[model samples]
Each structure stands twice: as structure tokens, then as C-alpha cells.
Target: MTRMFRDPVFGLDADVVRRSVENVAPPGAATDIVDLFARAAWSGIAEPGDSTAGFLVSAVGASAALAMLVERWSADRIVRESMVDVDTAAFATQLDRALVRWLPRLDSRSTVRQLTLAATCRAVLVTPEHPSWPERLDDLGPHAPLALWLRGRTDALRDTAHSVALVGARAATGYGEHVAMEAGSGLADRGFVIVSGAAYGIDGMAHRAALASQSTTVAFLAGGVDRPYPSGHSNLIGRIIDTGAVVSEVPCGGAPSKWRFLQRNRLIAAVGDATIVLEAGWRSGSLNTAGHAAALGRPLGAVPGPITSAASAGCHRLIREYGAVCVTTVDEMAELAGMSPGETNEDAAARSSEETRVLDALSVRSPRSPGDIATRSGLPVGTVQSVLGLLELGDLVAEKPEGWVFVPQRP
Candidate 1:
């Protein structure tokens, strides 16, 4: 006989709930199915960075909290039942306001639909219980995500010890893009996972350069992972999915709004060990990300640009007023992340010209035969084969059944 979960709180079919979440639940985590469903529902009901909702869930567990909501428990009753240490009268008033905000979106059917949509999109629901959940996000306290909707490799989130958030202006200048490309690829080579919003200009260039360097890069989306925002970067997001990850606190099918975009910046700041603003105007949104990093006490760096350029103003402000480290090179950026750049510099110095040429000849997506690589790199096939062997051992290039391709190292 098959056991069924028929909790009236969910207002969802037991089989449907089981089927939708069973595979998507993080493997090896001792997660209760009903609790997972409750958390998923809460994710859609509460807007991003809802501290009151976080308080409620933390007070009595997600399942119990949802059950209380379903049972129409009064704010007074909720505060009393939660037994949290606080001014009961004031807490009840706050809870009442939160209830008013949460009650309108408490449709279980909609939540189930979102869950089904997540399953359809092949996305995973990563709760705090998951081993891969980025622990650094806990620093957000009540503002942290209850669960993350993730697409692509889950390992990307698990390996955040050496992550850097590269954020800046969407209207990036040529100088900004050049610096962004250098920092992105250089940091990647030094074994740091690049994190960024998938917006155009500096963010897009940062992601592309990381991919080109054959390294893991994660994008934090303001909208649902299913509906890639900025629609222009759909192809780029797809490439990230192939190797890294696309993550969001919003449930599947949620739309990105200005408020959500601002809140999203906090996650970018929280997840990374350090954050760098490559270029921005005085009022650029990247400054918002920088602000979050500063508040979290994460190492913050800003690349200095020409004083005359408007695109550089935010970086200048961060350095001059906000106490951000002035980072002009990848080595400086690495130091900002508390990594000594000496070994990386020595390794870079030791690499022969042939190795660089062979690497430059390989494509991240398309595989090429040694003879073709030799022709493209202007090296003899024998030398190309020798260099390929060395690069393969270094995990920079991989041999596919078809031929040779650039392989991004997973952090």
C-alpha cells in the first residue's frame, strides 16, 4: 500500500506533490516532503527579502506556519503560539500586517502550479537543508532566501568558497569591458568562480570571459530561471546552463520588477566572498550591489577609470567615499578576495608561448582535431599534441570522442 500525504493545508493532490518534489528535492538531505512543499509555497507567496515571513517561518517551521495560515489563525494566536521572545503586543501588530500581505497570495493551487512549472523547466528547489545551499547567504539573517530555484549544475552553488561577484554598469564603456574581460578570465584562471547578473555590458562580458577561460560562472537572476529576463541574453544564459548555474530566490514563472532587482543585489553580495564594481555611473544599479556587499562586511573592490568618464563615477565614489579597495588589475582583485597572487603570477610567467597559442586555438563549444588546432595555432601537429597533453593534465582542455575542446574547471 502506498502512503499518501493528505494535509488539508496544502490543498494539493498528494500524488501531485510527491511526484513534483520527489526528484527535485536535494538528494541526501533529510527533508520532509510536506515541509518542502510548504517552503515552495512560501517562496511564491512572500516577495523576495520578506523578513517578517522569514521570522514567521523561523518561529514555527514552514509546514506549521503554513498550516496556521491555512487554519486562519489570528495574529494574536500566531504570536502566542510561536512563543518567541519579544513584545507580544508589538509583534502581534507586525504579524497582523504580514498576514494581511501574505493572505492574498495564499492560494495553494497557484503554488502547486508553480511547483509543476518548476518541474517542467527541469529546475531544482534548493532549500537551506540542502548540502549545496550556499551557507554564506545565512549572513543575510532574516533577509535570506527560504529556498532557491536553481537551473543547471547544482555544484556551482556548493562551491562558493572562492567566488567573486563582478558587477557594474549595463552601459559599459570599451575600457570597462576590456578591464572586465581581463578580470573575469584572469580570476577564473586563478580558480575563482565568477558570479554576476546576466545583464548586458560589464556583467555579460564578465560571464563570457569566464566561460572563455573554461571556468564555472553563476548568474543570479531577478526573475525566474525559467523566464530569462533581458530576453537578449537568452543564448548567453543557455551557455551558462551548459556549464555553470542560473539561480533565483523567486519561484518559477515569477516576473522581475524594479524592487525585485534591487533585492536581488543583496543575494549577489551575500553569495560572493568578495565583490568588485568594474564600472558604473554615479547612480548605477551596480552601486546597489556594492552597498549590499559593504553592509555584509564582504571585501569590496572598485576598478578606477578615467575621472572624465561618467561610467567610472560609481567606482570612484565607492573608492573615495565608501572605502572600497582600488583594484586596477586581476592580481589586485585576487588579493581583495584574500588569495595570494604570487603562485598564480609565477604560473602565468612559466607558461610557454606555445601553450598560450594552443589554448587560444581551442573553442569552448566546438571540438577540433590536433591537425586543425595545429593549423589554427600555427604550431606543428607534434607540438600541438604535446601541448594538448600538458593542457589536458592541467584540466584546461579535454578530449571528447569527436576531438579536443576547452573544459571549464568546476570550483
Candidate 2:
């Protein structure tokens, strides 16, 4: 006997619901097809981090709560039916506001399309009921995601007990990129799954280093997992999908917005065991991720940079004012994530302070002479020459007929 989910407000074919979820849903988990469909609908109906929707779904099952909405049940009636032990007046006010936000997105066809698109993209839909769902997200309380749309290994979410989120400004500097690479590869070698937004700069470098180390990584997107945002990282996101996971609270085919990106930070903070800000400017969006980590009581670390560099101002701010631990090496980061100290290559015969300063002074494009490098780096001309020789030996810098220019390293 085929079961059809029909209501006055919307109708769903049970076969379509089952087909959409069969491959993604774990065996012997969430056999109720209607409930799964309702959860998928809620993912599109509510924006990321909608507390009212979270409260409703938690108070009642997703199906019943969605039923009340579709049926146009009054706020008072819903409170009575759900038997929630809250003050009627206060709860009703919240429900009324939530209704205003939710009702417009209650179309059944849109949800069906989302499910179809997800199926076509081979994306997995993970609800709270799924065994592989990350329980750490429950700490988010009412702001937690109602469901997750994933591409790639779904087990990555379950295995996040040792995940570390490496986040920073999209406009990362050479110094920041270098640090991100070290942190990403080092942490991965120590068995920590790297987590990031998959944006350009620090985030992309971190993911690449983790991939280079042949370790698992996870990227949380602000938009649909089907449509990778920033378009530029589409190829990078595809690579992440090969071994890692790309996640989103939004369903398939949705576009990224500023508000969605801000809300997405909370998931990165919650999903990772700890959060590290590699490099950020004064108003960098990565600070938003740090704030969420603080609120959730997750360990937060910041990498300090040269005081003269404005790119690291957010990290400095976090260490000085927000009580974020100052982390300079991969071991320090691992310790911040509650791992004991381990042997690391961070202290190896790497770039010296002079080398770093000279490298920073030289641009990839406009070349600079030794005198100009010394002036810009505030090092002696003789010292700059010595450091440049060492850097040239490492193939980090090359002297053109014009002057010395930085040779960017590929991850």
C-alpha cells in the first residue's frame, strides 16, 4: 500500500519523499517518510539559526509542528496542542513573529524541487534523527541547524570530535597564507580534521594543505551545497568533495547572502572542537566565527602577526581583549584543542625573522632592490642582503633584472 501525505495546505507524494531520502538516510533510521520530508521543508522554510523554528521543531516533532503551520493553526492553539510548558502570552508572541517569517516560504513545490535538486546532485540530507549527525551541534540550543545538506563523506560530521576550524580574512597576506598552510597540514598530520568555509585566502590554503596531507577536511558553506559560492572556489570545493565534506544548512539551489554568511559562522564554531583565527583585519568576518566559539565555550585561539600589519589586527584584538589564547605554532593550536604536546616541525630551521620581513617587503609584482627592501622591512641593508641570499637559495625569492620579487608558493 502506498501512503500519500496530504493536507489542505500542501501535499507530498510518499514515493518522492522516500526516493529523495533513501540513499542518504541511514538504514533503520527515521522510517517515517513524512517526517523526513517535513524536516527537509523546514530547512528551506526557515533561515539558518532561526530559534523560533528550532524551538517549535524541538517542542513537537517536525511533522506536527509543520502541520500546525500548514494548517494555519492559531498560536494559542499550537501552544495548547503541543502542550509546551511555557507562558502562553510570551510563547504566542514569539510564534506570531515566527509565523510572519515562515508562512511566506511554506510552498510545497519549492521543497519538492529542493529535494529533487539534492537527489540530482547526490547531496545527503541529514536531520537530527540521523545517526551520523554531529551531537555537538546540540550545544547550540535553539539556534542549531534543523537539518544539514551535505556533499561527500557524511561520516565526516560524526568524526568531528577532533576537528579544528581555521578561519580568517579572505584577503590574506603571504605571511598569513604561510601560517595557514603550516597549521592546516600540521593539525591534519596530528589527526585533526580541518574545518573552514572554503573561501579564498586563508580558508582555501588551509583546505588545500589538509588535502595535501591526505587527511579529511570539512567546509561549511553559507549557501546550498549544490551551488558553491564565490564561484572561484568551485574547483576547490569539488576537490574537497572528493575526500572531505561540504555542508550547508540551506537546501540545494539557494544563493549566499551576507546574513547567511554571518549565521554560517556559528555552525563552523559549533562543529569544530576548537576555533582558530589565522589572520584577520580589524573588521574581518572571521571575528564573527570567534565570537560564536566564545559564546559556545569552545576553545578559541588567535595567531598574532607583526604589529605593523593591519591584516592581523583582529587576531591581536582577540588575544588582548577577548581572552583568546595566542597560538603561534601547530603544537600550541593542538594544545588549545585539548591535545597534549607532540613533536612538531614548527621549530625546524624555517624562515628566520629577517627572511620573513624581507619576504613581506617584496611584492610578487613590483620588484624592490635591497635598499628598498631594507627600508620597507626596517632591516639593515647588509642584513637584507644576507636574508635575500638565503631566501633565493630556498627559491622563495628571485632577483629579476629590475629587482627582487617574491615567488609565490603553490599549495
Which candidate tops TM-score?
Answer: 1
Name the runs in model 1 displaced over 4 angstroms. Answer: 1-6, 343-411
User: For model 2, what is the alpha-carbon lDDT of residue 30?
Assistant: 56
lDDT of 1 by residue, 308-382 (tens): 999999999999999998998887787666454533434434678798678657765679999999997899999
How well does candidate 1 score on lDDT at residue 192? 86
**Number of clashing residue pairs in every model?**
1, 0
After TM-score superposition, what is the CA distance of residue 75 in candidate 2 from its true location, in Å?
A: 1.2
Local distance difference test values of all predictions, in order: 0.86, 0.86
| Residue 31 lDDT in candidate 1 | 65
TM-score of decoy 1: 0.82
Candidate 2 deviant stretches above 4 angstroms: 1-9, 23-30, 343-411
lDDT of 2 by residue, 296-353 (tens): 8888999999999999999999999999989998877876664434522232125566
Q: Which ten contiguous residues of candidate 1 have the minimum total lDDT? A: 1-10
